[model samples]
Target: CSTFLHKLQRKSNRKRSVVSSGELHRNRRYAINPLGHKWDHHNLTYRIVAFPNTLNRDDTRKALSIAFTKWSDVSPLTFTEVTANATADITIGFYTFNHTDCWWSPLHPCFDGLNGELAHAFLPPRGEIHFDNHEFWILGKSRFSWAQGVWLNDLVQVAAHEIGHALGLWHSRDPQSLMHPNATYTGQRNVGQDDVWGIRRLYAADKKRVCDPWASTSASANDEILHEKNCPLRCDLPLESELPPRHVPRWLKWSLRCGHKNLRTTQNRYKTSPRASRAEGL
Candidate 1:
């Protein structure tokens, strides 16, 4: 029993260390890493296979739809929802514990239960986003008022972040960017300029007409169109002074650590091995 307890303590400490390292890496610079691949085509379809019990079907759909819109509005790519089809370029769903990353499963890096990690996504062609169903997901603005015990992760904000991953973006060091691994819960929904620039780097924008009346007389229509389309939305990167200060609530960190303790206790009862413990219905 002492050996078992020691092992569990080591594992818990390791997990906490990883969390700390990830937090540090997420606040460094603009681009931390890249998926190294992107979709060949611009148009993409997504399907929501499962919904969380925390939010109704309509609310879940709305939150996800808004997330998709947030990306499409800034980028040249387009996303269409496929309700009838089970397969799509992107598959979004909610799973608890080790449902997606079981020993026998092909996928990996599963949810770490209620807290610790909220959600994750596969990059580019894989296009899979999985949310920890155990989370207290705040779907709409009004829903947060009724939230009680658990930390309420904003659905739209998380969705937008995950969607950025699905589109081939890596974790950004900018805390204000949507692609930041540890995105804050500030109730702001729009994707940051850094995120927009990242996606643009992956997929070139399709040709679109622009109205520019003040261009030099020598500049042809095609030249004006090229310049206007290349610099979509004015490319105003957020200055360091203008960026909001990183704000993580003290209670959130405490809640996650407490949740990890419960998870550790549950794992110990089943078995020390993650696969064996998961198989035994943890």
Candidate 2:
């Protein structure tokens, strides 16, 4: 999810109008749509597996489920545990040893830092996860805060971050985001807006075109058609690239001309559209 942002930003905007020119007759391509439908209507269950050592089984399980539910709220996806020996689209597991250096972090910024890399998860199609066994996997106060910490790093914070990875989110560089490489206590209570937006974008693609027979697997096919074929207008558009991000909301716009880095500001920025500029007093 975090890595996707860097990739998605490179693509140019798509045109949605109906055109008859053969050069403009774009082929259908598969891209994740931000505003697309979710998988909740379908009878799909994402199985989450856990390997607990120090963390209580019940509380850890509860926390993992809660993390998935956060994405479920924005997505129409439903998940359930598979009790039997069955394979699933997404599988969850934990690690106690540091055989793979994925959990080791010389770059980690946590207060205790090195002892706990907190948590890590593999992207979809390769589901693997590991948590630091050295940390107190229980819910208790940390050395930093005096508050009763019901959600420790190994449990709540790590679970949330791993779940983000499992959902196809890449780590975000933004400090306030849940997908950031470092974990924070504030991120545990809720998924950050950016995390939600990223998950919604990733799975939304899976919902609409993951295996859709009508769409191209590579999204670049849209620019190469030499023959004039009557294609669905909606299909030709960048499925995931066109819509504004979930965090953008309906009322707000990204004003590059505003010269304000903050998204929330009272003064509207300059605009190309005179009417909109006038409406906002830009």
In order, candidate lDDTs are 0.58, 0.44
Single out the weakest 10-residue window by summed lDDT for candidate 1. Answer: 252-261
The residue-by-residue lDDT of candidate 2 on 139-231, one tens digit each, is: 542344247443345356566666666555555544666666554544444566555545544654222422232222222233224101111
Candidate 2's displacement at residue 53, Å, is: 2.1
> Best lDDT goes to which candidate?
1
For model 1 the TM-score comes to 0.60
Superposed by TM-score, candidate 2 places the C-alpha of residue 198 at a distance from the truth, in angstroms, of 1.6
RMSD of each: 21.9, 16.2
- Candidate 1 lDDT score at position 131: 88
lDDT of model 2 at position 281: 46
